[model samples]
Target: MTFTGRPIRIAGASGSASDRRHAIAEFARHYPTDPVDVIIADFMSEFNMATFAGRRMDQAGNAMPAYDLSFLEALEPALGDIAKHGIKVAVNAGVCDTKGLFDVVSRMVQAKGLDLKVAYVTGDEVLPAIQNALSGGQSDFRNIYTGEKLADWDFEPIYAQCYLGGLGIAAALAEGADIVLCGRVSDASPVIGAAYWYHGWQRSDLDKLANAFVAGHLIECSNYVCGGNYTGFKSLEHGGDGWANIGYPIAEISAEGDVVITKQAHSTGGAVTVDTCTSQLLYEIQGPWYYNSDVTAIIDGIHFEQRGVNRVAVRGVRSGPPPPTTKVGITARGGFQAEAWWFLTGLDIEDKARMLEAQIRRLLAPSAEQFTSLKFDLLGSNLPDAKTQNRATVPLRIVAQARDEEALGPRKFVKPISDNIMQGYPGATFHLDMRQGFPRAVFEYYVTLLPQSSVQHQVHLPWKPTARTQVIDISPPPQTKTYPSRQPSQAATHTDQAVDLAKDFGPTIRGPLGWIVHGRSGDKGADANCGLWVRHRDEYLWLRGLLSIDTAHKLLGDDALQQPQLAIERFELPGLQAVHFLFRNLLDRGVGVTTTVDFLGKNVAEYLRSRHVDLPVRFLNRGKL
Candidate 1:
């Protein structure tokens, strides 16, 4: 094989199992003529794996491909097309069942009478290794979030897997495998691995691999790069409805490490623009250093350019050596938690909340004190003469969790309080269909690092008896300094002279910040990051001045709740005309423990952008949106 000047195209078929099965047809229809070299899908997340284990337990199933079949089902329509077009497929669809996934895919290919080579990369699972480590005193299995050792915990892990790098995937592809199935690898590894095979790039090619990593990162969420959850969705059409059947993203990485992001041909819905690319780029990111099992990609230097309509070139990505350890996702049972929401309408919302809480406490008097956690949230404020009925209605949500399943289970916990419904506060109503309100087991996620030497990466084919495993190289962890408490050191360089608050601008217009600025936010483990951007260059200066680190803190911070801006870090991307804010521990111990409706905090940016801010007439009139 010889290197080509043309870049190899990769079409992202789906983001998650939540994707519609018809998306496969969408990709198939376009891919026939366009001819992407490979198709990749990200079917699993941290939450997805635990959810899969629960589902498997519910079904009494003991097999692989148990985590999520939605991805495979989605691609069923395109399986023939994939084989016909000779399009390579790579996926992290395997959670605990790579063999099951591989069997199903191979059977499908055989049924079609297609000669496709199928293989799976394994050795990510370290359950036995974890036990050995614990026994041999090699690792502490300390929780990365809470810093608690797994040994002291009473719960046994339902699913434990360490994240793997792309090398195993690259190895399978290099061995001429048409499809490669992986379990618990990094989300971006599929694309990175495919690029590795096509370019024959070594694992140590940090800069080039970092470029591929960013490209993979950008497209891993599929339609996210195509404006599915973009903040500027409304403004993309400048206030008209243009979003419908949005196309998934397609990435091309040249042999020389050129990253171009685009979409399939003749797609009618969503768009791909610099703003959209920037929004997806910053999603689920912690800071400048984007660490992966393969490399530490420095995102600060990464830049983008809109090459043409729906095509953006990503470049200038720098990198450093990867950390010596791999992160292991240890999911164990955290007991049962259940929640119920009651609507308290009319006057005295706060009083009603208090009365309801008192009533519940009185009713659950015997069991309440025994609960590990009991909390109440009044969703709306008590105001005199509210303008709308929606505003007048406040949801009183009571959530309780317990280590004892029987104590918190349906009969013991839910019955006592649920039986006293009529005796509760007046005008109290409930959500009619609330199956989610029932007590269910909560899986706590404990992430910890395992030395790379502890993991064994290999490629296995059904026909081959000999598994091709990479030899291990040992080394002491590099003496690197990690500055956890250091805040970003950058100040506003330029301020507009004409935009004087009192002089040039006669009066300040009060409106939502979305009137001028656009943003995107997402949760990363327990923390969150929100990126704010502007279309007009003139608005950038004003936005930067208005949305300082202090302003971001003021918008997201709550002094009474004890959730302050103490851990918030702010960064700037002037080229994208965006400001990114990182909030540590923003979620109350993550989505599992958080009582808020937006548990993942995906809408945190919209929440902050909706806050009313004083905008100058100069900026507000620019959009007329």
Candidate 2:
């Protein structure tokens, strides 16, 4: 299965029929003499789904109708051109169900007797399965809502499937598929699978496969790796044409599976750098375990060295053992909740807001007679301790939660708040109308391992011009079921331990002036405001002193200074602090501060101002002293 010649190439067009046609025409015009093996067009986005569904509902009274056969009519001509060129065509941007599309294309192929083998990857449809598992399974998972779990509510998912990996592409290439259609496969899987087919690599060669996978991940998003998302990217001299003619990605892979991600040499304004490439590598990948259907890529290391202006040498990656279980996505019924806001005016706004909220709660008490569970909150006003003197217009928001649809239906619960607004409190204005709120639906996910024996690989040959239509159901390998040993009780104990550990740590030290500390869930990486803090120090001593000997050594290399004073003059403290404070404030407001600080000395200007409030005379000599 070794590919020789010039190498297998793929081009991508924008997701629409028209955009794809234009992009293909553009590609053809630019490479009048060169030929490619495959062309893929992607047109899937969240917004695309919403629009497609909306249109379908208007025309056919069902949103799913948009995915019908008529939708692909515009693409047939372009696909015909690809067949004529002896090239394969793929569509990476489309719906979740490949079977529906296959049925239509299969019928068309039978009628026309076209020499084309089509294959598609579909697994995002498994999200519902994952959701179900998260809700029903007895894994003692954290409640995304109240952050609590109960054994009585344990359940299991109806189905679970991994987002098909490069293996789909591999499967397509193996079966000699002329056109591969896929939904939500990792951006890099197509190229990686194609490379594997061309190189004839074995599954045991994990290291080489990982290198290829990493390369694909780096450039799969196209523009993000080609200066569009580069933080320091400078615009090219060629006006608007620089970004306008940006090309899709191409990877020159080797027999060992090492890849050089690049675009056509003659393509318009594009440059690949370490920053651009690395940013894409870190995009959606959660951690060391990069999951796919076929392989689990354990990214050991990533290094980018300049090969040329547009070429980067990606090397030094390692592989890890694949997961024992496959993850399932399931969607199920959770509960219901709603929020309503009101404007409160007059003196002692906080006090009046609290009193108004109490009145509404009394009115809703009658509805609770019908509902088993009901909860409410009054936002905007600080109630229970309403002694604050600073008075202003307050926006009061009331929210309620309930267990069942019948118990929490909007008609039964919402009108009570509106009915009581002006009866008990003066100057209380209700701004929003009470509308029925959608019931809260929880999506659960479960993880279970299937033995390696259950998965197998096979390839099909390309269709001949006069070949008869064939539908082969490739049997998957025998799946080995290995239930995780940890029970629901043990899992709950572990969660309790984690919560206790956090509480035991007490308050962390306040970040230096102009900086703050924060935490991210879901295994995301750490972020800090230290970069901004270093910029604000007037004496430059705080910034220089901030770095440990090891960090300074790594950052400065051989020129690492022995004394912090050496770099003092080189430091643009005021300018740096200004930028630092700007970002620090933004992050604080954007997310939230995790820890509180007694004093923020990182901003020298702010520190001096604070000192002026306490000791006016001493503030003038503070910097000099």
**Best-fitting candidate, scored by TM-score:** 1
- The number of clashing residue pairs in each candidate reads 1, 36
Against the reference, the lDDT scores of all candidates come to 0.75, 0.46
lDDT at position 216, candidate 1: 91
What is the lDDT, from 0 to 100, of the residue 562 in candidate 2? 26
The number of residue pairs in model 1 that clash at the backbone is 1
Identify the candidate with maximal lDDT: 1
Q: Provide the TM-score for each candidate, comma-separated.
A: 0.89, 0.55
Off by over 4 Å in 2: 5-7, 10-36, 39-81, 84-96, 105-115, 121-156, 182-187, 227-248, 263-271, 306-310, 335-403, 406-408, 412-442, 455-625
Write model 1 residue lDDT over 1-625, tens digit each, in one string.
4247678888887787677566655666566567688888888776766666555555555443365677667766777776777788888887767777888878877887887888887877777788889899987888765567989866787667888878777777776788888888888988888888888887667888888889999998889998888876765553223676677788989987789999877645777888889989988877777777787788876778999988999977888777777778776767778887788888877788898888888877787766888888876465568788776787878888887677776665666667767887887677665665677777766677787777877677665554344322223224322434234534433454224434544467888888877788887556778888888776776666666666777777462146642366777777777778877767765655455566777888888888888877877666644
- lDDT tens digits, residue span 1-625, model 2: 6777554565544433233234544444445455655555554432233333343334445445434333365356455555567565556544544555666776776667677777765544543443444466624533321234423334433332333456656767666787777654555566667767767776666676677677666655555566554333344336434765565555566776666756655656656655456545544443345655445565424556668877776765667534454432222222455556677654666677668767876777766665433433333443444455324445666655454566556655666666775575667677666563433322223223332223332222335353342232333322222333321111111222223322332333322222221101111111112222221133233333333323322333322242232221011112222111111121110111111121121222232222211112222233211
Prediction 1 global C-alpha lDDT? 0.75
